[model samples]
Target: MARHAGLQGAGRQRHGYFEHWRRKDAGKPSKLGANKRISDEALLVHIKAIHAEVRQEYGWPKMWKELLARGIRVGKERVRKLMQRHGIKARGKRKFVVTTDGKHDLPIAPNLLARNFSPAAPNQTWSSDITYIATDEGILHLTAINDLFTARWWAGCPTGPPDQESCSQASRSFRYRSANGRPLADNRWR
Candidate 1:
């Protein structure tokens, strides 16, 4: 039988070689049983239903797990292929937001430092800035005050965007007498 099928003696001895050729010649399904398998259209229906239930928040991994959890037995790679073919995707979380209004008619702060980052002494020139940090809970607004010469810095995590009050609070916390007694650099320009 192996010689007729063009399989050598060693190849015939390999597991499932004869069975595979036998099934192929007979036009029968393999041992894995194709009878229980549903059509791609049917599977896609289930996938779309689950996607809507979760508000399209689950990718292939989560979607496959959800299918298994719901008593629908399917392969993970199959789920991924179907989702990719059908243009199904998870809605990603927004990581960045434009907080600044550049078109507004707001008064800009003057550049007092004149690009001199290296100060002669500590407290001679203090700078402050505001930034954001992403956390599991939400985004945190960080207001930081820095002494250019000494490189000493203080930071405060405010609830919302760093406003005048938040920046003032951060500057107040870092109590150091400035050499020229100038206020902390305004962060509104940032």
Candidate 2:
């Protein structure tokens, strides 16, 4: 039938294209103008139907498949072009994070460390800091120690709410865990 139509070796839409859409009841409306007359009411209905079919997640290509399943012999390019013109697009998943404000009326210490970073021996000066860590159980607080001279670290404890007691606990951890016999001072940061 195609050879009889004389579309031999045809590259694209040329002749017999109407055969694909041949329906006795395909009363494809009137020759309305492009903008004012052409309303997407029907197409939008079809797209929304497709959207619901995929739980409102499928994009244009899959939506086009739904149209093609209904004996709608439209080209993929036409569907893609129509979707782009109508601002159809896919969305991405997002992950969220939380932030805290430490600038309230809570008692805060001044930064006296000032990046001085000078020490004669391993245990002579140590810097300690408390931080929060998320885990499978819950939010856990951590206390860490750093020696300024050899820059060695003291393994500390992970707990909740690193308060004055936590700092005192870290001081004891540094005392018992040090190999170098030099004493450490907890002087305020300069």
Candidate 3:
């Protein structure tokens, strides 16, 4: 046991195995009575007040800093623990934004493909979709065209939101010719 504990044989015997065991078994000393500067309940009151004052937008780190600014002496960890224990949380900056308006008067396109993804031959069927990408400059609009049968795709990055011109540009980039050497069907453009 002394060897396992890194204690020399003589030192272990002098200290007594039971005494060493007792000290080792004892857990961390309680800080509740050691520090009498402020009670948790009082600190919690201040935390609640600050939380309300900030409209509940401040998390534990910000809350801790605010408490310090207001002359309240409290540890950050303690504030975090109390806030977590009491279910205090920061609210999101913006409320949910409804991007899509399903009730609009805009004409909805017919589902021509009818969920038939696979085509019998290359250039027989094509699909297109628009998506946005977040970049340091701003949000970039991406327009993509896909040849279903060949599983080949072409993409174009437009300056603003994707529109008819962007789709045409993307299609023109890699438009495969049919048997008569004419552009592929315009169904994908719709």
Candidate 4:
């Protein structure tokens, strides 16, 4: 082929014509955008749009699926690489800690309601409980107060630490709503 192009002959030594191919820098990294078949800008635009649409919750695999769903033809590894290069990461799962502390000095209230979750009238029984949820931010302690009859949230206070203060705040919402100012059933929280 070289001979037909009049560049090299079998008897002649190799010259500058092939220097670009046989250079010592062959294994070195190429400049950015050296490969032009795939435009990084376009792919990045799509990735950014997908990230925004999904609220940055999708990791590489799910992000790749979302991109494919959006009609973008690209490999999963390519999307992974792009996200890594751009420092795009998903919200990680937070470590959860049980907030319930049974070893407390507060006196326990008697279970007057006693397994009777069903209340006959509103405000007759306001049940309260504390629940913990794991979020990317951190552990959140949610104290909820609800009417047993209607099963509606009378009040809810989401706070950190799940301490007695939060429980008091949640109960206050029910207390503030009591129209007759009557004490709660079972004569608690007076």
Query: Considering every candidate listed, which one attains the maximal TM-score?
Result: 4
Selected candidate, larger lDDT, 2 vs 3: 3
lDDT of each: 0.76, 0.63, 0.70, 0.69
Q: What TM-score goes with each of the models?
A: 0.53, 0.42, 0.47, 0.54
30: Cα error in model 2, Å: 32
Error of 3 at 122 (Å): 0.9
lDDT of 4 by residue, 16-60 (tens): 435544453686324332344457789988888888887889899
- Expressed as tens digits, the lDDT of each residue in 1-190 for candidate 1 is 5354654544544447667668878998776464487789999999999999999999999999999898778899999999999999999996667887789687777778888888776777777778888888877888777778878766654657667777767666665433354555763434
RMSD of candidate 1 to true structure, Å: 8.4
82-161: candidate 3 lDDT, tens digit per residue: 99999998987755544456896867876678788767777777777767777878778787767788777666546576
Which residue pairs collide in model 3, if any?
Answer: none
lDDT measured at residue 19 in model 2 versus the true structure, 0 to 100: 43
Candidate number with greatest lDDT:
1
lDDT of 2: 0.63
Q: Give the distance in Å from residue 103's predicted Cα in candidate 1 to where it truly belongs.
A: 0.8
> What residue runs in model 4 are displaced by over 4 Å at the alpha carbon?
1-36, 103-108, 118-123, 130-144, 149-152, 156-190
